[model samples]
Target: MTVPSGIYIRKARIQDVRTIHALLMDCSKQGLLLPRSYNQLYSHLRDFFVLAQDQGAILGCCALSITWDDLAEVRSLAVAPECRGQGWGRRLVEACLSDAITLGIFRIFTLTYQAHFFERLGFQVVSKDNLPQKVWADCLHCPKFPDCDEIAMSIEM
Candidate 1:
């Protein structure tokens, strides 16, 4: 097993599920992001974009879920603490944005507490009410649903 010194970003694969799930849970424990069950991760595994080292150690994971024909939400974005300052997060996000563009998605959104971080990537704050109602359909299952404290932000591709 070897590790890639340069950050390597790629689409999530079946084998990457557990690593991704662990990272998401770590972030979720600190409320940095939402947590996904193994079942859900498997169901939407392809929705994830990940950063892995040469030895295939996953550093972070993020997902882009199409909410409407023109809109997509960046969900479950979590970066490993030790890997936080290296820009792997930005890479993971750009990967998601790139995927959205490739899929003909023009509008991308996220609900996050890291306001400045996402803003640095050109995302702007938006009112949760301004977002489509369909986006809320998943709120029922969210730990912070209805009273979610995360700020809503969006970036145009």
Candidate 2:
């Protein structure tokens, strides 16, 4: 899908953290994703890719966090409601995937409720047990720990 004119994807900047946080918060309120604290977003700011207009209005965000030597997780994916259905979400994930490849990471996974969305991007459903134990460290902080219903999916580069 082609991105609309004036909207482009790029590495997230420190200034984008707050806007990104707001977008995530809205998604969280709707149970579309987990909310990220400002500290977490700041610390992992480099891991994010944002869809912003030429005028600096952030419309969406996604992150690719390296989890192991050869694995990374696609996390924090969200798109502003007004921007949905225009391919901004796909562009955000594609930006993360491109970054993962450039960093030499060939495997990417995501724990998400939108299984069909990720599946369309070539990710295959996988057992959560197939993921490394380290991945569960964050799960401990999740409200749905031990009972998470989010589907785990992965794609090989």
Candidate 3:
């Protein structure tokens, strides 16, 4: 999808992994998002959508990972510091939501500290207990497992 100012969003390609990783790492450092390892990024590259300029710099990235039959998680969202308030983050998320619909998935959720941001996109705050599958499957492995302070937000399409 094309945004104003010569930037566009597209499915991530092999070449964009490093840049995507960097974007996530930067966000992680600021506690905006969780950090992902190179291993995870490479294996799930197809799950990502990247925002890039015409000159080919990756300005932001987000991922949509299928979690169950009708549920998916929107994760690894990050926008470059310079690009944060320009709607690119929303566009990246819309891309993921569109992809979920295309795949016949109707529910999408996110574990995030940015609750207000997701709320602006129509996601409502949800209880972690409502996501048992996610809790058992992935949350168990998270460093902040038992003490996960991230708010759980979800949108039903």
Candidate 4:
């Protein structure tokens, strides 16, 4: 379902899982992102904030996973192909940032191929070596790990 922007962003519901999974898989298949298992989605359901209108059709998905006392990682930010070019991706990221700010988390980061896209959103390029070793836990599960070439970017709220 294509939901036009300009509506409120809210916490995702249990029923949104399957559709969200499909959204992630669509990006993953194109090698633009990682594929998340349904089990993982269920386990981290609360970590997500899905964008939709009053009717509640999931337009995009992004998760803010808390890591350590001062940092959080934004993962699996996939906007439907139809929704790209619009400001939906930025709005979704902004929603996560706003939520993080409310929770007192000011450091946010992401691993992505769309470096320029995120750069415009205030994310700066950073060396992967500077990231906490704990963050590598997820990388191990990625099909493209050490050899992976996604750029790492960060921002301070």
List the candidates ranked by TM-score, beginning with the highest: 3, 2, 1, 4
Q: After superposition, how far is residue 102 of candidate 1 from its true place, in Å?
A: 0.8
Which residue runs does candidate 2 get wrong by more than 4 Å?
A: none
Candidate 1 Cα misplacement greater than 4 A, ranges: 1-6
Mind giving the per-residue lDDT tens digits that candidate 2 earns over 26-139? 999998888999999999999999998999999899999888888899999999999987777887889888989999999999999889899889999999987865356577
Query: Candidate 1's residue-wise lDDT over 56-138, tens digit each?
Result: 78888899988888988888888889888777778788888998999999999998889999999999999888786544567
lDDT of 4: 0.84
For candidate 1, the TM-score is 0.91
Candidate 4 ranges with C-alpha deviation above 4 Å: 1-7
Top-lDDT candidate index? 3
* Candidate models: Cα lDDT each: 0.86, 0.89, 0.93, 0.84
lDDT of 4 by residue, 1-157 (tens): 4544465567888999999999999998998777899999999999898877667677788988887689888888998887778788887888889889989999889989888989999999998876765346677777777787888899997
Tell me how far the alpha carbon of residue 93 in candidate 3 is from the true structure, in angstroms, after superposition: 0.4
**Which candidate would rank higher by TM-score, 1 or 3?**
3
State the lDDT at 139 in candidate 3.
Answer: 88
Instruction: Give every collision pair in model 1.
Output: 2-55, 3-54, 3-55, 4-54
Q: Give the lDDT ranking, best first.
A: 3, 2, 1, 4
lDDT of 3 by residue, 14-51 (tens): 99999998888988989998899999999999999999
